[model samples]
Target: MSSISIRKAVLSDLETLLELEQGVIKAERPLDPFLGKGELNYYNIPEMISNKNTHLLVAIVNNEVVASGYVRVENSKIYHKNVKHGYIGFMFVKENFRGQRISNLILDSLKNWAKENSLKELRLDVYSNNTGAIKAYERFGFTKSLVNMRTEI
Candidate 1:
């Protein structure tokens, strides 16, 4: 098997990253009912790449971008002890690349970046029914801390 390497995403990586973002939305639409039907965007790639508070990363294999994710620095809630934390999102690994622990590598790098920035906590939101993703994050040492509830008004 070819080795996987993780690197910071650049503006040139935008095309592949956009497709990967669609992949994520496609996989998640069934798990979420509130998503819009056409051309939905969950992130701003160029701004993210240029933002000092965000770290966008892509996973490369055999000179191709196959997976992508990002972590952004966010202010903690006023009640929280820490002033800031890393908010992880857009974690999508291509279908062909699943089960290879590439996500773990991405998480490790993001965690390191957060620590280097003196952020004491890392947090992310996962679909409540996405058991596979939940298990993966659990295996990576993340504990369940919140469950956002919603209903039709």
Candidate 2:
């Protein structure tokens, strides 16, 4: 059992982060085919890395990137217009690292980051077919706030 450490991602970690994003895209595309054809647009790696409202956490095992997740603050446009919520996304753990509680560690780090940013609530979206992730999020005190539906013409 190797030691796993979680920390804020830096510019020097961009290459590893992109690689991890590739892995994430590969796993998620099938769950949501319309997600595009190839690698995900992780928005802007540099901006995400430097943004104060966004926290990117990387999990390293023996100095190698094994998993990552991020949480960012977002404004509420309606019911909670006065507050900002924390949205968690880009969660992925290497295949070999599954079942080792790596996801929990990443989630915890993201939650702490949200708290530090003064977010009122934390939210995330999971594919309906991804049962494992859904269960994990539930265990972390997340509930199904809404359902997203799509139809193809």
On TM-score, the candidate that comes out on top is: 1
Which digits, one per residue and each the tens of the lDDT, describe model 1 over residues 98-141?
A: 98999999999999999999999999999999999999999999
Estimate every model's Cα lDDT from 0 to 1. Answer: 0.94, 0.87
The list of candidate 1 runs beyond 4 A from truth reads none
Q: List, residue by residue over 8-94, the lDDT tens digit for candidate 2.
A: 999998988888888878888789867866446755878998998889889999999899899988987677755789989989898
TM-score of each model, paired residue for residue: 0.98, 0.93
Instruction: Find the candidate with the highest lDDT and give its number.
Output: 1
Clashes of 1: 0
